[model samples]
Target: MRATTTLFSLSLLLAVSARNTYRSVLTDCLNTASVPILLTSTTGWADEIEPYNLRFTPAPSVVAIPRTQAEVQSAVKCAHANKIRVSVKGGGHSYGAYGLSGTLVLDMAEFQTVNLDQTTKIATVGAGVRLGNMANKLFSLGKRGVPHGTCEGVGIGGHATLGGFGLDSRLWGLTVDTISSVTAVLANGTAVTASASQNKELFWALRGAGPGFAVVTSFKLKTFAAPAVNINWSYTYSFPTPAAAATAFQIAQTWGQQSAPKELGYGIMLFPGNAFIVRGVYYGAKAKYDALIAPLLAKLKTAHGGVEPTKSVKTLGWIDSLTDLAGAALATPARGYDAHDTFYAKSIVTAESAPLSFEALTALFTYLYTVVPPSSAQWMIIANLYGGPGSVINSLPASTDPSSTSSYAHRTAGYVFQLYAYTANSLPPFDADIIPLVEGMVTAMGEEAADLPAYAPYADPELGQAEAQVRYWGDGVARLKVIKAQVDPMGILYNPQGF
Candidate 1:
């Protein structure tokens, strides 16, 4: 017994010694990487690691802000040499805070450079550029645009790579589909551009499962013409009963599947009070929008005993429309963006063929109205329209071979539901009810229970690694793993839910 105990003690000592050796190596590398690096317990360390989702507070050992491509290569090389797990934070908007979860963080803040080719209509956006800033700059450059989330603070790198969608997505396709190529540094510190022609396999994995593979520096995206006349419209209704709300929701589902046009971007936002709003923007002329939407409005009023909605509509220019949607000015400062919130979110993508049953819809409304906390807590359910006959999002395959398509898992998704709950307080260590309430509400929707897929960007931090891998990537997980082995065999670019 004494000998066995001595052997165990020796093994433990050896493990500690090995850790100390690598840590020493890592320290030297960060100091020499020629960039501002925040180390744990240093002056600005705590603030640097505070992520957008206050629910998570990851204590990364180092936060390296690389200014140039060469600096990025050096930081990644050091992490690889020392066998430290790495994460890249583009905007730090990850719902699970995975962007801040790694022991060594590559904060992509200083990599903000945007260049556009006018003739080809392609924009080379830096990974650090936020969505709203990208839209504003592209508009200023050549009245050009790309599909992206409405959240102004979301970073372009993670958003575009992880299946970005927005009011204009059903019209232009996802932000991933707009990508032509990407410049990335691999685990081995080699910078390469992946596209249809070069580094083809890496391109496929990076579109949907990007964060796990490498440190992406910039994205080469296909741009579109900003419409001259954009219309912002909304209809708010207060339903007397949950059944009434379900009836209106079902009407939206039917119209979205059959009658809605690609130019018409819309969704039903449900509040905790059981009141809801069917709101969106139209990309084309106002007269045409009125003609196209009149039928749906008529149908909505006819359902649930002639429910009438309060309406609001206005015309705006390109930048004006985008700014309104963003709810803030569509421009970012050079640095120091600290927008954050304390919230829990769960998302599911429902397919075109498998629409939600009326029973499930009714239950979802019932639970929200009766079971959710009072008006004090803030919560919202956004059922965004993603699939229709005119939408390119549904036309593509999930991911296939022989040139290999994008790995975005929900090409057939008709609606992506974001069930979110937050406390009155902005800082986290939130009240206990937030998680159960959000999860239970999502469960009542019956989409995931029906085996519909999950969205990778709005990841649930609570899920186990294996379960999240399948839900986010499905069968594509195998190909992603294969690519990871080929590029990141050391598992350098990793998050908790990543392969």
Candidate 2:
């Protein structure tokens, strides 16, 4: 018995020694590599490791900040050699912090560079560049623009790869639709450029399922001439009861179904104060804008039963229009990307075939006002109008849509429903209570919309792996899996819901 105990102790000691040796070897390799690595003991390690969402704080084995493509290659090689997992972080805007984990983190903050070619109107942007900065840069240089998200802090790498939707998506299509080419490093530390004609399969996967396959360094995106003038319009109506709110929602739903002009973008925001607001933007003269919105205003007035919206409209330059849309949130450093806040967000794409039911809409608003805590940092329901008739995105055939080759499978959706719950403090029962409510809201939406799938870019970890796969990829899952196996046979790049 004593001899057996001694043998067991010796085996445990050998295992510990082996682990220590492995860690030491990896640390030494990273330290002596072509690029500098930030160890846990380093001075700026905390800042580099901090993600946009404070909810997820992972202690990675090492944080690597690469300044160039070669450095990125070096970092990947070192991690691969040591058999350590790797997660790539661009703008760090993932609400669930998928950009971070207990593995090695490749911080791309230092690779932010945007260059534009006026002749071809092609902008080459680093993966680390944020949407707001990119838009501002394009406007200043050549009055150019790209279809991107409203939140300026979102990174191009994750956003474009996962079907980027934005205010002007109806006009120009998604950010991925503008991508002309990509330069990325593969799982084996080999860098390659992908386009429609070159590395065709990789190109298709990179358009949507990029994070799961490669570490993208830069993108060559096609740009368009910015509108000469942009007109912003807003209307807010206070509903005294759930019935009134339901009536307003019904009216808005009918109006949304109408075939509006391609230049017009519209949506509704249901705030915590039982306020239903209709907001839109027109990329043309006031005369045309007024003519287009006249029917909407009349219908809203009639259905609202004498409750009128406080209306406002303004005309501004392209840059100012973006600033107005983003509001004061633009002034925050990194566009509020580094704010320490905790939040839960889930999104679904609703098709015109299955609209939100009156019962579900009523229940949603009632629950929002009654059960949600008043002290919550932020809570709101946002519905963005997309895939409108005559929309460039809708005009494309299903086979030609961006979702065809990529994993983004919600091309037919007309509106995106987002449920958000935020809190600054970590109080007890926050997750236990709020998370289920959020899920319930999404579940209700799914029921009303015929079990439609959720958007991939939102990245809800609460949705188990199998459900997330179906919701994000749908029929494209099999193809994505095959490509993932071929490209990353060893499964190097990974995330909670990633391939």
Candidate 3:
């Protein structure tokens, strides 16, 4: 028995020795690497590893803030050499806080370059460039902009890859669809360009599910001409009960499926007390906006003796329109992010072919307003129109709609529902009821239609890996895994629900 015990002790000692050697070697390599590398023991590492979503506290062992392509390659190579997992932090706005996941963090805060070719109108944007900065720069350089999310702090790296959606996406297509090419460092530490023609498979994989593949350095985006005249419009309607609000939402779903024009981008923002606002931007004149919007308002009035909503509309230039949508959250800092939320946010994308039935909508809203959610915390729901008669988002792959054959699988997303539960402040003491209340809203609808899937961009960390895979990627899981194995076999580049 003593001999056996001695052998066991020896084994344990050897294992500890091996681990110490491994970590020491990695430390030597990263410390000598030609970039800023922060060890967990290093001063200010705590501040550096802070997550944008205060709810998630990912403990990365090492943080490498790469300023140049060479530096990125160096950091990636160091992690790969040490067989450590690497997660890239761009603008650090991951709802799931996946950017600070894994053992090593490649924070791309210094790669802030935005160059727009005036002739071709092609913009070369650094992966680290936040959406607001990119938009502001693009509009100033040439009256050009790429379709992106409302949060200016969101970096293009994950946002574009995870199906970047915005008000303009219905007409312009998603931010992923704007890519002409991407310069990324693969798992093996070689920097290469992935596009439709060059490294085609990689390009296809990167478009939709990029975080699973490589460290993208920069992107070449095919920018659209910024609208000379942009119109912003809003309408507020109140209902006696949540069920009544659901009736209005059902009317909205029908309108979104039947008549929503591509030139129009809108969302129905639901607030407490059964109050909701149908607000968005139109690409053209106010008269045209009113005309296009008249059908919905008329239909609403006809239903249950619904009264006309309080209306507000304004016309603005390109940049001001972005500011209006983004409000004051557009200024994203480079190094450490100051803005944060203790929140739970998730999304569901219903197919255009399967608009939410009235029964399903009622179950969702009624459950939200009456049964589950308490008055302790704040909550919001927005059903944004992504598809209808002529939306660019509905353009399938291999089609002539300029929607290239990429991994983005939500072409049929008719209405993308965003559900959020949060505190008024950035600090926690987050309501325990928040997640269940938010999740049940999706589950309520899914109970009506079991095949309904969640959106990949607004990733929910509560989901299991297998469940999230099916919900996020749907039919593309097998193919994505195949490509992920091809490029990132070591599985260094990873997130919780990533391929």
Candidate 4:
């Protein structure tokens, strides 16, 4: 017994000594650098480390906030030398915690800078810049804008790389499509600029598969003149039965068959109370918007049978439109990053090739109304019209388009259906069952559409890694794997669903 106890004591001492040695090395390396390296026990640790989605509270050993490109390179090199895994946190909005799990986290929040060149109509944005701030800044500077995400808190890094969609996505392309160049740090801690003329292959991968290959520092993106006016319209139709709700969905799908005007952005939301809400924004004047939607509204009313809808139309400036798109609370400048509540979300892209049938819509509505548990927090289904007439998404065939070389493969999808369940609890007890339920809905939708694709940014953890990759990348997976091998040959940068 004494011998065994001594052996255990010696092992414990060795482990402690090794851990202390590692800490010393890491501290020494960071102290010599220019950025701030925060320890887990530091006072500001919680504030700096908290992700947008409270569900993922990562307890990384250290968090480094680099303010410059050189500092980012140094931090990556230091992490590599110390044999510590590094994860980059931009806006900290990765739903699946893709930005958190690592021995060291490179928090890019301090690198928030948006510089616009009026002559070129291009914006050079830091990876950490949030969409709302960027949009406001651009509008103030020169009434210029780039396609970005709807959520104000979403960061440029993940959104642009994965696929950034917004109210203007149909008119302009995705945010990634607007990127003219990218500045990133490779696995070997080498800083490189990727653009059409420089590191072409790296640029192709950086635009879409950035997280899987390198740490992006900044992006030079093309900007467009902001629209003068944005007209918002909404109509809510309450259904008494699942059949009525399903019929409304069918009519909406039929309307979707005809290419929507490029100037208009449209979507639908289904709430727990058997309510289907149709909401849209027209970039032009209110009169033109009315002329475009009037016929569709008539057809929808006819399809809705006896249901009467509460409808409203309002026109606002571009900035106000952005505020309207994101909830009023989120758009509030005072609302801090920590204000966002914990949430679980899943999404699937529905293509025009295989639309959701009426039977499938009814079944989905039934499941949502009956099987899904009701919680104090909000949960609902959102279907966004991601593709239509003016969408440059599929303008060129995937085989020939340079933009298609990136891993975002759902360009052909007409709409993206998202299932979001929000809660205050970071670790909800019902997560186990809830996750599967959400995945089941996606599975059913995929089956209905003969195996359609999923959006990568949503990043569903419930979908097993292999299946998630197939869903996220589709045929692009093969090319992504080849590039992954070439860039991150050491397999340094990685995430569960990454290349």
Per-candidate Cα lDDT values, in order, are 0.84, 0.77, 0.83, 0.77
Which residue pairs collide in model 1, if any? none
Clash pairs, candidate 4, are none
Q: What is the lDDT for 349 in model 2?
A: 77
- Off by more than 4 A, model 3: 1-21, 304-306, 372-375, 398-404
By TM-score, how accurate is candidate 1? 0.94
lDDT of 3 by residue, 1-499 (tens): 9999999999999997986676677668877876788887888887888877888788877788888898888888888898988898987888888999877888888889999997888999998899988998888898898999888889998898878998999899999998989999998889999988898888887888778688999999989999988998888888776678788888878887788788888888987666778888999987888788888889887664757778888899988898889986456677666778888988787887878888888787777667545446678888899888788888656221244557787877778888898876656867767888787777787565555678888888888898888888777778778888899898878777887
Residues 104-155 of candidate 4: C-alpha lDDT, one tens digit per residue: 7888877777899989989989888888888988888899989877888888
* Candidate 2 local lDDT, 1-499, one digit each (tens): 9999999999999987976676677678777875777777888777877776666676776778888998888888877787778888888877677887637788777767789998998999998888888898887888899988777777888898877877777888888878889999988799999888877788887887678788999999989899988898888888877867887887787677565666887788887787788887788898888888888888888767766789989997787888888773433334235555566778877776666778877877666667655356566788888766667666544523554544457667778888877663743234545676677666653466546678778888788877887887777777778888988877777767878
lDDT of 1: 0.84
lDDT of 3: 0.83
Q: Between 3 and 4, whose TM-score is larger?
A: 3
Ranked by lDDT, the better of candidates 1 and 3 is 1
Candidate 3, residue 420: Cα displacement in angstroms equals 1.6
Ranking by TM-score: 1, 3, 4, 2
Off by over 4 Å in 2: 1-21, 329-337, 374-377, 397-405, 424-431, 444-446
Clashes per model (N, Cα, C within 3 A):
0, 0, 0, 0
Global fold similarity of model 3 (TM-score): 0.93
